[model samples]
Target: MNILIVHAHPEAQSFTTALKSTAQQSFEQQGHQVEISDLYMMKFNPVASQDDFTELNQPEYFNYALEQRNALKQNHLAADIEIEIEKVKRADLVIFTFPLYWTSVPAILKGWIDRVFVSGLFYGGKRFYNHGGMAGKKAMLCFTLGGRDYMFGENSIHGPIEQYLSPIQRGTLAYAGFEVLPPFIAYHVPYISQKDRQDILVDFEKYLKHLDELQPLKFPVLENFDEKMQPLN
Candidate 1:
């Protein structure tokens, strides 16, 4: 199966990068086609601009070099955008790997969303379920968190982290029509031992091996993943 792994986080030696590395190695070993968009490594611009809008009749053209053209179009569309979306259309299963930041996805990954998920590409009007641009895809999240798992509890210091990422789990990916599996959360990243890190890496390999089967990530009702979640915190 074809897989798209979008990674965010600056440090190449970070636990987050380690996770991405594990995922990549796993897929390669299994002979699955995998593509990665390392947000920091790519130096993906996080801000948006007016050209992404233009006049209503201007036909919404995109150019990333503008540093503010509203969005990135060319290369990424065929690469990042098409990689996962088409993998959904042609194959099955899309996985996103990142580090949970401020209880949400890193700003650059969000920017990837804003830039790539454009009209007539991932969504459109009329048909509500499974009929739009990305109706039948499957998606999952694999992320590492800095604070202890307890810190994400209801009354903890950071509030509910799972709840915080609902926009990504529900609004963005699921809205695009990928059936989301139970998100794989790796908590307490900053506190792990070298051995512990290695173990998680091994575990990630196992996750990829199992995920190799491939399936669509979608839901059909109101309490479902897409329509019911609130926006990012």
Candidate 2:
């Protein structure tokens, strides 16, 4: 299967980078083709603006969604966005690797989502959730965090880890129609020993090797809702 890894850490030697490398090697060992988008190395611009379009749809009032749809139809999207879209189109699975920042994805990665998951390309109209533009694709997250695993559970200070990740998993990936996988998280990486870190890498390899056998997170189907988007009785 074709796989795309979107890596968003600034430091090459960081634990997050190690996880990215581990995933690449593991997938390749299983004979899967892999591609990586190293955002920092590529100097990917994370901000969205009028500059993203070759020409504006409404020059008087800039509505990003309107401009994006127009640009996509005109084949006038920004070069970088076009490239990213092509990568997503080719990949059967897309993995995101980053360090947790402020209880969410790094700004660069979030911007990547905003810019690349464009209207008329990734999602629009009734094409969302199970019927989204990217319906058959899969997405997973691999991240490292400074906090201990226990700290993120229901009875802990930070609450459930899934709560912190719901925005990305459900709002972003699921909304785009990706079959989201359970995340592989390396908790307290900075506080762990080198041996522990290596062990984590080994475990990550095992996870990748068994990726095909893993079940995706469950989500509601479009049929579950009525035209107004309320759950049908």
Candidate 3:
């Protein structure tokens, strides 16, 4: 299978990058073709602007999504976005490797999503969730966090980790029609020992080997919803 790993960490020696490396090695060892998009090393621009398009559909007003649609149709999307989109298209699975920032993805990664997951291509009106343009693809998150596993739960200070991840997992990836998998998280990396980190890497390698067995996370399916997107039940 073709796999794409989008890595988003500034420091190459950081544990986050280590995990990214581990994933790449593991996937390659399994005989799968792997591609890496090192956002920081690539100096990927994270900001959205009029500069993304060669020519504007409506020069008077700025609508990013509409412009994306127009650009896609005209094949006028910026070269960088087109390249990333092609990478996504070629991959059967896309792995996002990053360190959790403010309970969300790093800005660069988010920007990658905003620009690459274009309007007419990745998603559009009534074309989200199971019906999205990327319906056949799979997406998974592999991240490191400073928070301890105990620090999050229904009875804990921060509530469930799933709660913090819902926006990215459910709102974005699943909404874009990726069969979202359970995330592989390296918890409390800042406080963990080197041996512990190494153990996590070993465990992660095993996780990657079992990809076919991992059940995708459940999300809303359009079949159960009416035209207005309300549950038909």
Candidate 4:
């Protein structure tokens, strides 16, 4: 399988980077292709604006979605976005590796989503959820957190980790039609011992090796909702 690892950590020696490397090595050992989009290393522009398009449908006023659709049709999307899109398109699976910041993804990763998951290309209208443009692909998140595992449960201070990741898992990945997998999280990496960190890496490699056998997270199918997007009940 072709895998794309979109890495968002700033430091090369960070634990998050090690997770990415582990994934790559594991996949390669299994005879699968791997590609990395090191966002910070590439200095990827996270800000989405009119500059992303070569020719605007309405040059006077800039509407990002409208321009994206226009640019996609004209094959005039920005070089970086186009390149990223191709990477996603060619991949059978896409893994996002990053550090959890403020219960969300980093700004650069968020911006990468904004720019690369373009309208008319990734999703639009009723083409979301199970019917999304990227329906056949798979996506997973591998992230490190500052908080311990117990701090993020239902009765814990941070609520549930699922809640924190719902936006990316359901709204973004699922909406785009990728079969979402359970995330591999490393909690309190900064405070953890080297042995614990190594154990996490070992676990991550095992996860990659068995990715195909893992059951994807269940999501509401488009058929469950009406034209108004209300549950059919």
- Clashing pairs in model 3? none
Quote the positional error of residue 90 for candidate 3 in Å. 0.2
Off by over 4 Å in 2: 224-233
Q: Give the root-mean-square deviation of each candidate in angstroms.
A: 6.9, 3.2, 3.2, 3.3
lDDT of each: 0.66, 0.92, 0.93, 0.92
Better of 1 and 4 by lDDT: 4
Q: Write the per-residue lDDT of candidate 4 for residues 55-157, one digit (tens) a residue.
A: 8889998889888988998987999999999999999999999999998999999999999999886887666889788999999999999998889888999
TM-score of 4: 0.95
Order of candidate numbers by lDDT, starting with the best: 3, 4, 2, 1
lDDT of 2 by residue, 187-230 (tens): 99999999999999999999998888999999878775456753
**Backbone Cα, N, C clashes tallied per candidate:** 5, 0, 0, 0
Off by over 4 Å in 4: 224-233
lDDT of 3 by residue, 55-166 (tens): 9999999999999999999998999999999999999999999999999999999999999999987888767899887899999999999999999999999899999899
What is the Cα-based lDDT of residue 138 in candidate 1?
70
State, as a TM-score between 0 and 1, how close model 3 is to the true structure. 0.96
TM-score of each: 0.73, 0.95, 0.96, 0.95
Indicate whether candidate 1 or candidate 4 has the larger TM-score. 4
lDDT of 1 by residue, 1-233 (tens): 77777888799988888888888888778887877778788777665554343322333553443322222233323344444345445546567778877777878888878766665456544323454456666778999887777877789988876678778877777776667776767878788899988888887777667763645344554334456533321
